[model samples]
Target chain A: MKKILSLGLLCTTILLSQAQAASTPTVSGVFEKTVHAFAENHAPLGQIPASDLLNQPVAGIDEETGFLKVQTPKGLVLVARAAVTTTMTAAAPRETSCSYIGTLAASGTGSSSGFASNCKAGAR
Target chain B: MMVMFWIVYKFFDPLSLESATKNSSAQFFSAITAPFYGLSSPRSHQRVAVVTINDPTLQQFDAALPLSYQRQVFILRQILEADPAAVFVDFRMAYEHTDESLSLFQSVLDEAKSKHIPIFFARGEEGQDQIHLLPPLRNVESYSNALETSSAYPLLFEEGNAALKEDEPSQEETRKPEANAAFDVYRSLCTSTWSGQCGSFHEDDFRRPMMIQWGLHVDPAQTQVSSLANSPRNICAVPFSGGFFCRSIVQSFTLGFRAFWGSSRDYEVGHAYYPLTIGAHQLGERGLGTPAGSPPLSHLLKGRAVFYGTDIRDQHDDTVLPFLGRVPNVVLHAMAFDNLVTYGNHYFHEPSEVEFGHGVHIGQAEICEFILWLIFTGWMAFKFYYSHPEVPRGHGAKLRHDIRRKSRDFLSLSLSVNALVPAIFCAALAAFDLSHQPTLLNGMDEALLYVCLFLVLLGTLVLLRRSAQRSQPEEAEHAHGPEESEAEKAEKFRLGFWAHLALLTSLTAIVFALNELFIQWPNADWIGFILLWLAVGESCESTGFVLTFVNFLNRRSHALTSERVPNSESSSQ
Candidate 1:
């Protein structure tokens, strides 16, 4: 009974860890406006939804492609280097209100979405 | 003989032979206007500025096509803000457009109109004589008051028309009806948005078609363009006046463009032009900030007459000029405009009667001067041969010797005179060309005429010498008798020939050097100057020849006398 409980506990820990890995890390800091967003072919995709981008987690940038990886409700979005206009600001954690005003395009290959914004990052 | 020669020369059109020869008379004109190497008339400097829509500027837009209407509006706004003297947009704007783009474009046009800035748009013909603005823009008449159409037509007659009788009024009348009827046919054939005439516009509900004006005028102070107004219509209209007979004349679009923008300099007595050029990329760089490394557009464009057109390599706007092979159409327009405003069209007389007369009078003066030259040269040749005939030298041996010596002198004199004629003529022509005033004849024609005269003189001299020789058998035999051997006689002839040839060559060199030096002297009579030099050269050559011959004779006599004295003294001893 002790061995079975220990095995169950191990399985539960692994599953929890997997679940944690699947859930994206919450990105803090102010959201900035976007400048331009485009697909791989450079076709302009209009404005991306503010709610979709506000609390989305950044999944690190791809070094080779220079794309910004962001986790959204839909899927993992890759913003091309050319499309990305906004830089992330690391600030003291506070209620930040941001507004974006640039282009957004779907990321083609591995990423499910892409966006380029130049939003105002400020403490509300 | 002179009359006959003149008749043959004038009527047979010997000057026209210049076309067949490799060294054509046209080459002389070509050299003067040669773009790279030829003399640049002060007028060649940029007078009008051309803004070209180049490849890089096109690339800045999406899909690298012609500028979208929005971009055009932006560009137009920037240009209008710069406040040029006039703006000529050499693009068609007669097409269906998006409502938004049309409204935007209309607003820009309105702004330009309100500014009182003369903005001219290019008018083009659609399929089967249909007149329309170039595709995608509409409601042109609502926005702009004036439209620009091309006056460019075939200036030269085709082969079929060459056989038509010049004086046949019936044929001319027939041609007139055909010509007059064609414009209506053309109007019917073509469809247009303006609902007015293809080449005309409505002025206060009265439709007036465009006229072919003789010249245009731009006020230097106000920069206002005006056509030759109130001129008699159909006065200079030939059957080939591009099918527009008795039409009220107005300045061509290019001419009007030039009057406003062309840069001019007072070169000597007349004006010379330098066409201004600007690139579209530079304009875009200044306004939109796309392409890098362009000059600030404002500095070049402000208070300038700006012309905008497409100059892409494969866009087919290239034209061939006299020496400047294929150049962009805008450049051609600039050149033509410069030619009209600065030089005025000497060939066509739309400018004024006085201006046309001035050109004709200059031509007449040149013809008169050529005739005088021919007469004087002919008289000089006649006098030269007749005035200095050898006097009879008493009897037998002495007379024969004198005749032989005179013949040798005549040969040298003839050679020098013949060579001098052409050398002087060439020098005179070069000097005339370089003068501030226009040249009457080109260098090659002058050279050809002089060379022909020299050949005639040479032939006459040869015939005269042969006849004189034929008549003097006794003198010839005595002259060739035992005093000189055949080989020695042959040697003397060879030496005389070489000496004559050397003199000719030296004279040619001297004349060339003089030509270069005297090329810039104003109002100098080159003909009289050359004649004076020729006379001086002939006198000097004759004096030098006489002195040398006398010295040679004295040496020979002294040697013979000394040898004879020694032989006698030895015999007596």
Candidate 2:
């Protein structure tokens, strides 16, 4: 009985860690290919997915300012929410995988269109 | 005094001083000897080459970031094709990678192994953390025949604190077993690559981990086997064997290089192997443009151990070394490697008489030599004191005459004592270079000790002369029929005591200032010593002047008081 209880606890712990690691939305297909291409070329992407851009834990999000605060390897980055456009799949599962398409403001105030797939549900 | 000197010498070794002030006499000796033996000259025929990853070379690569592993693979492939004697990769691959780049790197290493080209990669320690090859490159270890790894850690000559046991593991016991295991892996890798077998290398062979002797050709006429047999490198007994077994040792990294390239040739000293450096753009140019006119890069790498490392400004992979000051880490490794292979058996070895312990143990011979020095110094001090007796009081004209007569003798004595400074320095330099034996104390410490001894003896002689003079009957007063009173004698003694105390206090203050200055400003140490001698001389002169002036004032006051008292007595009568 004790062994069984310990085994169950260990399984639950492992599952929890997996869940935490998978918390960040993943991208596939064209969006994934494009990011890989940009990384190879050592170029900054036109638009990066919020999950990919932020990779680490969120510090805070200011709804009024439309700023999504997330930590990056360099430091915290404040990504503007107005630049993000989310397309919700109809009748999707509770943990929905949505598509987020957006534009990144370039140096000259021009916007470049960006597309992302496999975004988690209920994420702004 | 000898005991005090010994205490200071034992505890306050100059080599163990704060890093900023520390002078590595060993390094100094090596540097000086190298030039004399033609080891450092470009004409000396050394075969090692350094291929620095300088700015221009990096600019040829994918210029956006540092050269990727894939590019390094291409560079290694180029070096391998040159059919070099061996290649030692000094850069550590400590990062984890799971990308396609990893496979590409592994394939290149596999190719090198298939070609039977011995390639040694550097292993790094991540602080006190796990020691392992970069996850991707760990596969290369399977290629046991041609591939090996060595610790890229610098071996330091630190004072040993713990006692050694016959059967038990010594200092290795103090470290984490995991770290020791990691070191063992590195050691085995080096040994297998060098000797084609694990467990061949022994701990007793090295003064410290990774300290290897470069198999230098000492006598050009002697056979390699004979030289190897005759070399007097340090050996340690196998644990628990009761001194039954021992193994000849060399450093792991140098062993790897030597195992692959073989022993260095005679007349290889002074000559350096300059690497054929190609830029990224040049590498690209070779692919795009005509390759017929340009010599093949492999042609340049042939017959050399190609070393590859970054020499960028921002990387800060530089160390401050003795003689050379700040140089790139690669240069130190190269110089050490050169020193080993070119002069290993000839130039480098631990003195057989000394034993390693908490500090170096001077053998009986050194102790005898130290005792002899003590006796010589004591004799010199005694002779100097007796020869330069103090000028007696009540012989003003005679004292002046004596001073005039002895001024040359005083000058000669001062000159003779000062001359010992350079003589001691030369003797120290000679001992270090010729016999590889450091004196009980460093040159500066010995000089300071002698100066202090001289001052103490001088002070004692002066005090003794003063006391003797005080005890003597004043000839002038006896001739004039008046004897001095006991009260007057006591007063004079009290005054003399205070003057001596004042002089001692000033001398102590001056010596303290000089010592502080010497410690704070190491570059000015010799100057400080000279200044200290001058300051002592000046203080002695000033003290003498003050004493003479005080005596003159006392005499004047005494004469005036005596005259007034007689007049008063006459008037009253």
Candidate 3:
């Protein structure tokens, strides 16, 4: 009973961690990337999502103001270039059954019957 | 065997193992001791700043080699405007420029000279022979651009050695041999940055090539997964990334064992410290030079050694640092200079050759290692041969008799205790000895000292407890057990001599080979020390100092052999 409880707790903890990791948004590159602004004390001020830059990329800079021009939900917005930071997050590899099958085949088992059975079961 | 081991150790250089071992070991030491680096939290060196002509800067200027002289002038003017302590230009001007362009570049040099902001231009070596500044532009200083293989950078390069030999004597050439740009900048700025401790300008005071004690700077904002993905280069490459808390927690698990052999390229940049870097484009931005209310550039560049070098992505001018991976030439130069400024000539030196009075010279590390080897061997001999009694008559003679009855009985709990206690004690002592100057101890040194001291205290306590427990006189008469006869004892003694010799010789050979292979390697010394401790422990066990482990193995093997033979007649056949 204790073992089962521990196993359940481990699984729940893993799930919660995964959820927390997923919630945090990641951005790459210094130009035309989605950026969230922070206040002077590093408080969350507002976010300039990639969609605001037409979901593609824009390098429009207001020369006088030194602000990056972006189209927000309400209207056009200009964000301070210095305030915006490009936070690079590592991309986790998503493993699927297809990749797993590839790995097994790559091991040189030379067993056609097993491969066929696995393929028939839609394991790919 | 001891003499043979020493001879092999002394002459062994089959592979260029010295530098290779030291480089790998230094990297490992840097990584495992990284947490201690954070004890003095902000490891971002404030004295040096890298102003990189990055990909964006190159694109913005549309610059290409034989880089236009105008761009060089612009960059110099921009840097000088911010009032840098010194500027090291890691760019080589290979192509001849027009008269107008040369004058423009020369004017900037004039400006730098006027402001007392010493600027050093990159002088060529080996491959790029054509790299020479125009006569008009050679108003300021020049430094050798040659990079050494190791993480440690050599400051002084004798003129005849490299590109400086054939070159016409310039006004910048001094009585002292040509120093690297890093050293020149440090020499110029150190007096003010580090007042009296920097010492006089005497030639003998400086240790030629110094290993950089890489810093561990953990910017909390960079801890996010997104930041890691984008710019993973600057973060400490350890498993946990909660910064100081994570390091402190993981450090406890490693203990002193991880000190000798650490994770290796993978561990190359594990310390995760890079100098504060700004793009050339950023520094040249108009608003940065505005002298109104403490501009960011002013704060960043003022009195700081600025390295102006190109960091173009596919550029060939790059060098690999043990703790910083492959960085631009300027970054390496900046880091070397930063080390000099911060430590003030107190950097790691290559194992110096020790002279023994009558012109006999040997490596300092080698002599110490040999002495240690000799001491260990002597101890082994004493334990294995001298300490053990001929007839086994003592308070613990029954235990010794039991060991003889069945060799498996040699593996006693006391043997393990004896082994571990000495091993721990020796490791603590070695760690303490490694950092000889306690007063000049950095974060890593302090960490090692603390951990080793703690272990030493713990080992002492364990020894005391064991000695106290052993003092009780139980089974006094039966201690010298009447087990084996006189003839059997004589036969055992005859055989034991050869057996012990073979065992000790083999153990010493293996330890010596490992030490040679990893002499300079990161934890190699630690690993070597631990092995020696174990060797000592094993010898102690052989002297009937509680041999439970060896005894168990012997007993298990005996039982297995006996079981294999179903009948005695069949077994005999």
Candidate 4:
């Protein structure tokens, strides 16, 4: 009974968080996408979620070469070399998935704390 | 508890582990490339801020390098490890930064997009009449908005000038406006990706494009990478928008002094890395070891994760910085990337709140305060014991007193408990010993000592007045009061006692002040040693009344002559 109650509470919390994150943002730029570009080459594999990339920083990219690299408990590894990346637009102009959530400000993720959710609001 | 939480949240948090590890390593590379930078935060949390128009209509002005959303995911995934808070791309879809070798960017964009980034061509902005106009964006309703918010990125608008210009600023013009030089803005478009990845590539990337962290916990490497065709030159050449990444948050490295100081100017900015010269002394260099045969990938991954990035200077051509002038483009990337991480934390906050990276800077203020309080307390304790010796003290008193006497040059601990002047001088010498920036705690300690000085001075004056009153014959000749007579003698003794204390204090103040300003230590380790010395000296116990006052808390014993006084002994008064 306790487990079920907690699960219900968690679900409600997630829904509430998503509702709050769906508001329109002023001057939206690509925040989460940028984090994705950042995390694409830095963070290690297996544990992290695709949604949480913006919340984490894994490594640094060489400005000239654009190679992304990270250090694990063992040593530093170059995850990806420098590359030209992209941004997006909505063809139908409907409620965007987290991708177009930047200009198309919608709801945030309810998985983490307030700041993490708030981070999604202004994302491009 | 809050502080502990913050520490755990930033450093040891399980959620940020993989990404944090990546950022910390990137920071290390940045550190190696630019050893001169004094960052507000550590290497991992380096920041990149991008400012640009987001409307698609504005992107129609020129060609945008074709980029995709899947690629964006691949790229943003890596940069997230360095702990960057924000990766702002200034433009809607037109973007990126420099050097003659545009091939590197071409390849990076291609690989990133092919993997998973979502991208599309310039979309025409819709008017109420359903007609496409000058700006081809679908998000906002107006064209004036795009024009008002952004200027041409430096990358797209560069003047490839061959000559370097140097208009030297006069000595006093430190914050000169002309410090910024003219540069070009480049334009390119990023491909699209899924919801989690699309918003990252802003057009300011053409010049001052804000970068995001790029490590993906998922194997973005195995994912097929794509390119932005809009980027005319780099469609599929350079892999991974060149070695770029950002992390979520770089934790602060708040440094503090280990102990009270000694003297030394051992931590000068360039000098720490190179022991090039110490006064007339010169040091040699450590060279790289001989090259070895390349190891297999499996062997390389045995104990260490192999990181590959170009740290070498541009063998092809040098790049130009707006203000600093020509240098290697690779170094520029290294320096700029390093600088971004270093100075990143300095922003997103008020000036007063920004830390100036004083991690390695040691100053006189901290040492002065720590030493003075320590010495003054020790001496005061000793004097209290001296004024009333018949009061029982401890066996350690004699040993402490003897050591103090031997250490001093002129004053005898037995006759004069005023060790303030010598101790301060010694402490001042110690304060000069610090080579590392003292923490805020040290600064607070120093402030407390300042209050101590003021109180001590005021107390001295009161003692002086008491002595004068006791010396007056009228006060001494009071026949009706035995208590008053004894008080008169006590007052006189106290006056003499305070005068000695005051003199010692003044001398200490002078020594600390002088050492802080004029004398720079010639060595680093010596400074640490000196601070330790001063702290030790100050911590020593005073063998007089003050020591007894503290010891009284632990045990109680009072005897004027070898015998304890009973309650009836004081009834005569």
TM-score of every prediction relative to native: 0.35, 0.39, 0.56, 0.21
Residue-wise C-alpha lDDT for candidate 2, range B210-240, written one tens digit per residue: 3212222222211110111111211211111
DockQ of 4: 0.01
lDDT of 4 by residue, B1-573 (tens): 122222343336458643344333323222221211231122221122111111221121111223333333333333222222222121123232231222333443454345432212221111212232112222111111110011111122122321112432355244211101111000111222111222444423323322211111111111111111222212111222322121111111101111111111112100110000000000001111212332211111111111111111222223322111222222222223332233231211111112348764323423443454446545644543343334455655665556544543233233223335434544553354232322322233333334444455444544544444444555447434454332232333343545545645444444433433343211121222232233222222333332233335323333431254233122112
Displacement of residue B5 (Cα, Å) in model 1 is: 22
lDDT at position B560, candidate 4: 39
User: In model 4, which regions exceed 4 Å deviation?
Assistant: A1-124, B1-382, B385-573
Off by over 4 Å in 2: A1-124, B2-10, B13-45, B64-66, B98-101, B125-130, B139-294, B322-325, B347-376, B385-573
Position B320, candidate 3: lDDT: 57
Off by over 4 Å in 3: A1-124, B6-24, B35-44, B94-104, B125-151, B158-174, B191-201, B218-272, B286-299, B355-361, B388-452, B456-573
As a whole number from 0 to 100, the lDDT of residue B3 in candidate 1 is 35
Better of 1 and 4 by TM-score: 1
Error of 4 at B260 (Å): 21
- Report the lDDT of model 3 for residue B371: 79
Cα lDDT over the full model 3: 0.48
Show the lowest summed lDDT stretch of 10 residues, model 1 chain A.
A99-108
| True lDDT of residue A109, candidate 2 | 20
